[model samples]
Each structure stands twice: as structure tokens, then as C-alpha cells.
Target: MSRVIIRLLLTLLFLCPILAHSQLEDIDLKELVAGAQEWAEENLDTNVLDALPELDRQKAQKFLRDLQKQFQGEYVINLAALRETANTILPLLESHEETRPYAVWLRPRLDYLKIADEFLITIPPPKVEPGEPAKPIPNPGPIQQRAVWIKEVERRPWPPAASNHVARLKTVFIAEKVPPELVWLAEVESSFDARARSPVGAAGLFQLMPDTAKRFGLSLWPRDQRLQPEPSARASAQYLKLLYERFKDWRLALAAYNSGEGTVQKLLERRNARSFDDIAVYLPAETQMFVPKIEAVLLRREGIKLAGLVTPRD
Candidate 1:
């Protein structure tokens, strides 16, 4: 072989691993989209389409377009290529933390992609004729279906006793600089019963478990401080703030509050899913309904008489 051929071969050998590593990272991101789709399909209640802002849609669209350019050499999507891409990303996502939610959320949309024979198709512009006005292109079928899931949450049956504690919880949450609207959550947990105790040992209006109570500075040694309304309310607010920081979404934060942050975190790992709604079906039945119950109470308190039970959102 000539010296030039040998040099080129050596250079390619050196660059191969670096290129492979880059592709691995790219695959993880693709898995995130897939996982999100999966979760959305798994939980039929919430609309992943409506929750996203314009910027997020644009970002996802851009990411999808980038992947298309990378893999769609001939400009046609095929099942084998899509399957190979999914297999590469799903395993890597199993152990991931931060991006795991996105993966869980995106994976299920593959059915729609396969059925529709595309990922996301552009809504075509209006068609015009020589004399007639332009006829607007209709919203595509998948997007229209996705939009159907977006509905307003309805009010729940509020225990009269629950409203009695709202004034106190408002004080506690406002003192902590958290949203006072969260006061409604206690209504779902324990019907605002200060001395309430769950079958699993969660106590007080918030029904915090033992470890969670201790983590928020509750003294359970000489006496169970979780039974006290004032201390328990404060601790609950503080804990919710921490959960909000961790999940960055109120619904997920509340899920952590109900099921233990560790439980939710582990659940996120297991499903590689997104928000509470995305992975709701995989959670304990009580934990699954926790956020919706909270939303229902909030809507009732605000005097919005919605008829049906809509999915809870962030």
C-alpha cells in the first residue's frame, strides 16, 4: 500500500471511537423523544401536545428534523431503521435520571408514527384558485387527536371539613413563599383531618411518611410532631418546595409528596417516562389519582364548576 493510504487508514481508526461516542449521545436524545411518546400513549388521559409551549414544539420539531437528516438518507422512514434507533436508545435510558422522563414520554408515539407512516407531518398551507379564495389546510389527524386530550380539570367532592383548614394552610404556604393553591392537596390526602393517619404510617393533614417527616425537621422522637397542624403544615410546605425543586413540575412534585420522592424517582428510572400523567398507569393506584384529586379540589375552591374529571396538569 502507498504511504498516503496507510496514513488515511490510521486517521480513520483514531476518529472512529470519537464519532461513535457522539452518536451514542445523539441516540440518548432520540430515546428521550421516543420515551416521551411511549408514556403519552401509556396514559391516554393527558395531552402531551397541548402542555408544550410553542418553543418546546419548535425544539422537538427541530430535534426530529435533525434526526431525520442523520438517518433519512433517501427521505423515507422505514420500520427497521426506526426499530434499530429505538433499541439503541431504550437501554441507555433505563439508567438515566434527568432525561429519563422525556424518554418515557416519547416512546409510545411510535405506533402513531408507524400507523401514519411518518413522525410529524407539516400542516400544508392554504390552496388558492384563480377566482376563489384560499381554502385553509386542515390540522393533521395525529395533532387533532392529540389536541382532544386537552380538557379542563373538574371539581371533586370537597369535604366541608377540608375548607376549614385552608386559612391555616394558606398561612403556612405563603410563609414559605410557595403557592397557596397547594393548600387544596391536603383535602385529597386526609380530608384536612389534622390527626389523620394512613394505613402505611403517614400522619397528619399532609399524610407524610416517617422518613419524609424527619427529613423536613419534624421531631418524631418524644412525640409524633406530624400530628400537629402548625408544625406539620410548615414541614409539608417546606417538603413540597424541595419536591418542586427536584421535579420542576408541580404535579410530579405532588406525586413525590404522596408516594415518597424516592418512589417517584425509582418509577422515573423504571419507565424512563416524563411527568406524573405520563407514568401514572405504572404507579400505585392511589398515587396515580393523587394529583387529579388535588386539582379537583383546587378547581372547586376557585368556584369553577367543571363537569368532568379532566387530567391534572402542571
Candidate 2:
């Protein structure tokens, strides 16, 4: 009898709150979980079809499932975190489709990705001499001249404000010695357009991926901070700093930014190549084209004939 009473007490205690809440709010945990899962799966499938290779598709799909399992205990989906993971796999997404699917499930995540890209575009790493600065040499080798041209093309320009914004960026990119001209890279990248978005889902002035932005400390929460020019630029600078540190070459860093870091890393591993032109051939088609575009733009900006070439969009 005592045992039965204890069991009854336990049941009442457990049931009372649920009954009360059901009457007042009508919450359904199972329904909510099902809806979230369905939404996630549909979105994952779209990304898989649009951006992944067959082998990578399988891996990415499994990763998404793992995300679901990882978040099963939580009631709400942390879309920002999940989206970051997805953007890292974007290179895999390109072969399958020319553009991102604009479905509701995919749109928000892509928006976040764009914000990240913009942020990364703005901030680049500092340029540092690998060793103690040698006394100014009378002449660098042939390789040095080519490296200088490569640096000239990757430069980013300061925003409208020359002193303030430019100085701030220099601080974040402290890892390596940055060329002064390459500061314009961000300008050509998105015309300092914070809200800028690429067709393939790259976004902002820096045009960082969602994952890259988040990894570099930009928040893609309800609203992504990457769409803000100054902040995005700072983030982009930070990411570039990391890339330069890893590759120790400006051209390779730029190429890595435009294409998959993985692809560039693999190429570097396989070849004894040191020049951007050599490594560039192994990169994706878009990146090969990217270098020349940057070069042309820089040339135009510096030339007197094209004095009024770049005008801010209204």
C-alpha cells in the first residue's frame, strides 16, 4: 500500500506541470522536433545537390545528420553554427551547380555565408619579413620582381577615410609584412559594398564564406555582422592574416582565398613550385581568372588614362 502511494505521488508530480502547460500554452515537443528535423534535412539535401561532388555529397549529408544528432537535445536549431559548417564545403558545391538554390531553407544560411565573406574581404593579414630585415639589398632576384607584381595585384585600398580606417586594418593583419598597395584588394573585391552578395553566395566586401567568417569571429546569428563594411573588413583582414601565415606567400594566400584552401594546399604539397603563375594553373578556373582581374583593376586605378574608372555605386 505504501509502495503504491509513493508511485502515485511520483506520477502526479511528473504529470502536473505538463498538464498545466498544455492547458496554458499547448506546446508539443515531438511536433517541434519533427518540424526542425524536416527543415534541416530538406535544406541539407538542397545544399548537397547544388554544391557537393558525389563523394563529398555523401560526406556532407552524413555531417548534417551528425549535426542533427548533436543538437537533438536542444529545442531550437542553432542555424548559424550549422551554416558555418556548410560553407566550408562550398568548393564541393560548385561542380554540381552554377548557382545556389534560393529555397527558403537555404536562403537564410546563404545570407549568413555572404555576410561572412564580406567581413573577410575587409581584413587582411599583416606582412612581416620572414627573418630579420636584411640591409636593403641593391637588387632582389628575378623571383623577387615577380613576387612584387603579385603583391601589387593583391593590394586593397583604404575606404573613403584614408587615415582612420587604414590604420585600424594594419593592426589586425600583424602576422606578416603586408604590401601597402594590396590594401586595395578589398575595394575591388566588393567595392566596399557591405551588403554585396555574389551569385555563388560569396558576400560582403571581404566576401567570406559563412564558416570562414564565423571561424574568424564574425557572428552570423539572427543578423550577420559581416554585412557591415568596417567590421567585415576587419574580419577579412584577420582571415587573410591566417592564410598568409599558413602559406607564407601573398599570391598563394590570395588564390587560397578565392579557391578552396584544400586544393591549394594539395597543389603545394605535390609540387616544388614557388611562383603564383605555376600554382595558379592547378587552381580552379575562377581563381586563375581572379589574379588577372585584380591586376587589370589595379593597373586601371593607378593609371592616369583611367583616372575616373572607379566610382562608388549610389
Candidate 3:
């Protein structure tokens, strides 16, 4: 299958559960699959399609399928298996100009994979009692995970693209009345790479999804403004500002940014929670990791805690 088809299948397998109660809840599974297959056939990147035929089809399909499964699995511990595959794929993706944008998207996430593996190695598995089912061990809470991520991130050098983009992006955030330091979000999202794109269609420096991008006044056709740093940054900042306003807390705002506002809001209401920590465990594993990862990135880049961030100025 083509990469597009593979991604579509993986999305259906993994993301459907996460989206079940969100806006896409009512979507018909069969129709969604048929539409995705048609889109894949119609919109396959010629270069990628051409390249696919030259590979050993079975091996390639297996590799791609396994990669997608591990990457999209609900548990962070599953990411451990992806580290080697990521290293191998990163260089290959970077070697082709047509595929380099994917490399940009994958590059920063390699850190997450590495740290997740380390976390698994460091934390002992929960002990099981005789004649009882062995339950999975829960990950450390966000506060503990944030400290771990801060240490990991602190040792890394700043992404080169950030030097060129941060000043410009910060100005856009400030113009949108967002806290300028929050512009470092690009570092966490895309490593400040304007061409970065997730397989699920989030794009650009801030990785704005199509729906969110359009909601914030970005044009998707004729030209995808999400790939333009200033426009994407403006949309991102506005979205963040709106999220912060809704949650009245930066940690909650960041969580909503990653996992959808509806998802975070519902969790908060269900749990009677006012803070990210209260609902963190109930969140999808990616969101659980994501909020703390951003906190670590912010702390490492700007030396500010999420709680220390000020509201957008008028």
C-alpha cells in the first residue's frame, strides 16, 4: 500500500477511539475508509508512488505498518521500539528533497521516543499477585514527567531553525496579544521548521490541523497559509490565547491545544477538575506526554514555568 493508504489505515485503527466523542463522532467508519482509499488513489505523491514500486513490497509494507502502529499506539512505552526505526528512516527521508518535510516532522519527535524508552527502562514494572491479572503500570504523572523531560531537553542544543524563526514568530504572537515566550511552542511542535507536516494533516511551524487552521482564519487552498510562518504563528497564538481564556491556566491551555478543546473540557467536567494534573491520567497517552513535554520545552527555552506565564496583554 502507498504511504497515504498506510497512514489512513493507521489513523482509523488508533485515532478513531480518541476522536469518538469529538466532532468526528458521527462519521461512518466504512464511508471514512472508502473516502480515504479514494483520496489515496487520487492524490498519491508521484515521486513517493514511483519509489514504492522499486522496494521489496512485503518488507516495505511490514516496516511501514509496524512503524505506524508503534508510533500511534496509546502507550508511551510503545515508543521505545520506534527509536531505531526512526533513526533509520530519518536519514532516508532527509535524503530525498520530496520527503524532507517528513524528516522535519520526525526529527524532534525522536527525542520523545528516546526519552520514553529511557522512562520505561528507569521505572520498574508493577508487581503482580498470584492468581490475579497483571495490570499495566501507569506512567509517572505530568509533574514528574516534566522534570524528566526538562533534564533531557536541557542537554540538547537549540534547533538551528529556531534562531532564524523565533524572533519573527514571537513578534506575531505578541501582535496577536499572546505571551511572546509561548512562541517557543514551535520548537516543541515542529522544531521551528516551517515545512514540517504530520501524517494526519497538521502542518507548519506550529503544526495547526486543518480544522483549527481554518477556524483561526487561515486559508487552506490555492496556498496553505499554515506553511507560512507568520500566518501560522498568528493562528497558533490566537488559538492559544482562546484556549488560555477558556481554561484560565496555561497547562490546561496547552493540553487543549494538543488534544482538542472539547476533549480537555469534557475531561475536566467529568472529573470536576480545575488543573491539568487532575485530568492528565484520563487523557490519551499522547496528550498526557504532550502537555508536560511542552512545559519542559518552555522551561528549557525560556526559563519560565507554565503557571508563571502571564495572560495575553491588551
Best-fitting candidate, measured by lDDT? 3
Model 2 CA deviation exceeding 4 Å by range: 1-180, 299-314
lDDT tens readout by residue for model 2, 116-216: 23323433434557885543212222233334434444454444533444455444333224433444565556554454443233456567656666667
lDDT to native, each model: 0.50, 0.46, 0.69
Q: Which model, 1 or 2, shows the larger TM-score?
A: 1
Model 1 residue runs over 4 Å out of place are 1-158, 303-314
lDDT (10s digit) by residue, model 3, range 140-242: 6777788888888886778888899889888888888888889888988898888886544567998887777777999876577899999999999998998
> What clash count goes with each model?
21, 38, 0
lDDT rank order: 3, 1, 2
Per-residue C-alpha lDDT of model 1 across residues 82-137, encoded as one tens digit per residue: 54444444344333332233344334323323322322243345677789986633
Candidate 3: segments with Cα more than 4 A from true spot: 1-73, 312-314
* TM-score (C-alpha) between model 2 and the true structure: 0.43
Clash total of candidate 1: 21
Error of 1 at 123 (Å): 33
